[model samples]
Target: MEKQKELVFITVIGQDRKGVVASISGYLYRKDVNIVDINQRIMTDGYFVMSMAVDAKAATVSMTEMSRELDQVGRELGMQVQIQHENVFRMMHRI
Candidate 1:
């Protein structure tokens, strides 16, 4: 049987700006994280919001390290970035 993919959820929120997607995606690419799906938009208030589903089975680092590094990237972009396991995210958002 095939190994199951380790799914992760990534969320980004902040002011609208260039390079946010590029920078994040580039970093994931380098880390061997595959972005399975992504959705982003600029809200009426001009804030940028993005959510991504990623497969981290091939990632070079652990989730804790990835979160720390992504946090640094978010700080540089004046944004808040968060990562969580899919199950945890779902549980947190469940109605």
Candidate 2:
């Protein structure tokens, strides 16, 4: 059998507030996405930024579907959320 792998890079940015991490993480957990790495911090201007890498090997969700749901989460929290494939992210980040 061929191996199927789905990796995504998710970024959430906005003002600092409670439940930001919880809400996003909860959604990932509910979708059976294994979180590989998470980095969150508060900027000097007090804005919150979060970056997460998730493995969707066992998820029953597609990238577009996941993005749509996450968009709702972002709207609810007044944050700007971005979801992209790992390869595209890496390419953009690489030197």
Candidate 3:
């Protein structure tokens, strides 16, 4: 049987900072997650908004576990982070 692919989407919003991406990317890296796509932009309010899709099946990590870790990262970075399964994300984002 072929291995299943597990994907998740992560969003981070906060005041623009130098190490925001580094911090989040580093955390994901340590968890062995493979970043599939990443996009970040600054809003008129000056808050940085980042969206990323990661593949966890390659890293053998669970969505719940990764989400917990991301929550910790958000707390440490003083940002709001949301992690969601890719399917749910797509459904919610689809018009």
Candidate 4:
């Protein structure tokens, strides 16, 4: 049987700054959350927004814990970050 991917969607929003992606990606990497897809851009006024799809099947922490930790990391980076299960995100974001 093929291994299933337990996916999570992560969103980050804040003023553009150095190391925003590095800090979050590093944290996830250390926790073994594999990033499946990433999209990020800076608005005309220098605000940054990012969305990522992560494979969390092998992560060391649960989704809730990961959210909390990501929040902390965002605070450290001076950003706002949120995470949700892929199903939940897809449901809410569906057109």
CA lDDT, every model vs. true structure: 0.92, 0.90, 0.86, 0.89
What TM-score would candidate 3 get against the native? Answer: 0.85
**Candidate 4 lDDT, 1-95, residue by residue in tens:** 75698788899999878888799999999999999999999888887999899999888998888989999999998889988778886678896
Model 1 pairs in collision = none
Candidate 3, pairs of clashing residues: none
lDDT of 3 by residue, 9-83 (tens): 899999877888898899888888889999999999888999998888766467777788888989899999998
- Every model's TM-score: 0.88, 0.88, 0.85, 0.86
Residues 1-95 of candidate 2 have per-residue lDDT tens digits of 75477778899999989999899999999998889999999989888999999988777788889999999999999999999888986788896
Compute the lDDT of residue 35 as modeled in candidate 2: 91
What local lDDT does model 2 show for residue 3? 46
Error of 2 at 21 (Å): 0.8
Clashes of 2: 0
Best by lDDT: 1
C-alpha RMSD values across all candidates? 1.8, 1.6, 1.7, 2.0
Model 3 RMSD vs true structure: 1.7
